[model samples]
Target: MDIVLAPLATDITCAPSTAVGQGGALIEARSDREAITRWLIEYRHSPATFRHYRKEAERFVLWLEFRGLSLDALRRHHLDEFEQFLTNPLPSSHWTGPTRPRHHPRWRPFRSGLAPASRRQSLVILQGLCGWLKEAGWVTHNPFALMRDRRRRLDNAAPPVIERYFEREWWCAMWKLLDPPVEDAPQRSRFLIARRRFLFGFAYLMAPRIAEISRARMNDFRLEEGQWWWHVVGKGNKVARLPVPDDMMTLLREWRAELGLSDMPPPHDDSPVLRALDRRRGVTDNQLYRVFKDGFSMLSDALIARNWSQDHPLIEQLRRATPHWLRHTSLTHQAQSGIELRYLAMNARHARLETTARYLHAENDEWQRQQARHRLSRIE
Candidate 1:
């Protein structure tokens, strides 16, 4: 393929022409291009990856400045400190998707759950940077060649809510049946709670990733052969079909009509399946999360109001109670409701049995204990 170098940050292509200055030095204002920067862009590493390189390099530069060593005079210790900085730097507010929003309704930082594999990926990139500097004869040695990290704990490689959210029965009642409070929210904000309850009930009950939900346009949903269904694009960009709840079908209808898009916009085949009050901003992963947070918080508040102590047997043993928890509830309810595992796998849209196995995580334990204590109830 022919190399196409887009001029970065300016109108000029490559470097501008330079003539010899009076002192017999080339009149170039900056140094010539390096090979690694070319490779980074050429390898299809995202612009965000390039941004990280600049930031990480700056961090290394700062550490070197504290020790009074310029890049030309930098040594192994400088690179090692930079590695440490990446592992446990200042709290990264730079995180995107679910964790980016500044308003922490709970007034706490999102817990950083970076996985071992992720840290390893970052470390490998740094090592590669060091290797490149050496190969290009820019450095005498690859400083990080011998340096190592105590690999980050294998963390949940998803946003925090993805790890913790589980929809139990108590939570469902709290969110769906009871409308929780929002502090000084605008009239439009009232939709926040409702959005969560129904969306959670609709989607997680069916188990589509937030990405699939966002990617789903009205065209992807259809009444195929008289059944309401969604054509979801799952992980790895694969397509899967899902059945939607009738109540959800209604919610979608009202929400669209309320927004008046039906007048200005076309039918189910013409617009996004999920949208916001403000159409242009679009739906986001964090929006998906904030939907849950509002739901969970409202639910938690409602349960407290209804004369149920957090210590009550039902509430007391609720190990998890976020939106994903509802997913567990949905699956368990289906299992108890006699939905087959085979059908559950398809409805849940999990590619592997082990992935769906997580949905069954607490079910077997809950079932056995319920059966042992209520053995007489099992008799028909």
Candidate 2:
């Protein structure tokens, strides 16, 4: 069944389904529900986000079809089922990212997102959709509201979350860690290695979002008054001033030279920073990811080629790390080094001090001892 959201303005003008916007989305919406949904079309959602939600809605529609429920027939149980479906996805529907991160040549498990985390995100979306439906009088109550939330949990006993500084020894291997340039790589393996290394490097040093990295314009970096600084448009559409490490600036300047970008550049601050090293086109998110995937595979293959396995603590830790983990590493280490939370917040581009605090808290021995004492002293 096509799940239609309420339209933008009054009279409920029907906007296109995400698939329609994509120009080739599948037929998952029921004719009736498709007719009913108008709000989602009005609500602000990116093309990618809409497309993802549409497909997920289609999945639910298909499952509803399996149970012979029409759009008008959906109740609390139906929404509950949808919630459970997201929580305990069929093995067949599981998503896999670059397992080895294309860091190495060998195939590693693509285990970046946890099932629970994904489930919660999906539920949140589902809740929003269902709440819309209920408010529109399509349903009496939202079924999704009844479902319990799941947390992002990983067992330290078996598969622990990776925690290690991308300091020197780890750093040297990490940049080239993912598979080296693949002769057969679509963007070529060599380019992938170089690009992701830059991405990994830039994010740690600057703490920009992955999207910001992909959208980073050429003119964002500047050497002014003998100091290099990066002007970044951060999440929530906020503008931020980020410190440009001298070494990172060197790499930036070099990459710009390779891009044939001018030393005396245009005045625009939003030009993409990291670009396609392919020499044919400017980079998109896909290129960034492709490079990342291939790079990780290459990196992993390098480790395995030398007979490394996940059983090794270092390899296991690397296996669990992702790009955001690098951001976390930077903030954690900065905080550990006695950087004030407020200062780190500014550098981290955090709008809220709490959000930065999560990254800033040091969980080492000294902090742990404090935690123990606090717990011991707590009033029962």
Query: In TM-score terms, which candidate is top?
Result: 2
**lDDT of each residue in 1-380, candidate 1, tens digit only:** 12121222212234532332233222222322332343344333333345446433434433444456644465656655555555664434332124332334422222443344445555556566656655544445665654543233212232121233334554456445534326566757655544554476565456666655666676665777878777776654556877877766776665555455552223345566556866434586657656666655555556667777877654543423444555656665565556767888887766665555555545666778888875455566
List per-candidate RMSD values in Å: 10.9, 9.3
**For residues 1-380, what per-residue lDDT tens digits would candidate 2 score against the true structure?**
23222211223434443332223333333353463345345333443454446544545555565567765576756765665655544432232234332224342222333365455555566666766655554545565554443222211122222244454456566655533344566544455455666666676677665666776676777667877777777665678877777768766655555455665345574556665554545676556655554555556667777887757655665555555666777777677779898889898876667667665445556678877766445586
- Structure candidate 1, residue pairs in collision: 165-325, 166-324, 166-325, 166-326, 167-325, 167-326
- Could you tell me the lDDT of residue 236 within candidate 1? 49
Provide the TM-score for each candidate, comma-separated: 0.52, 0.66
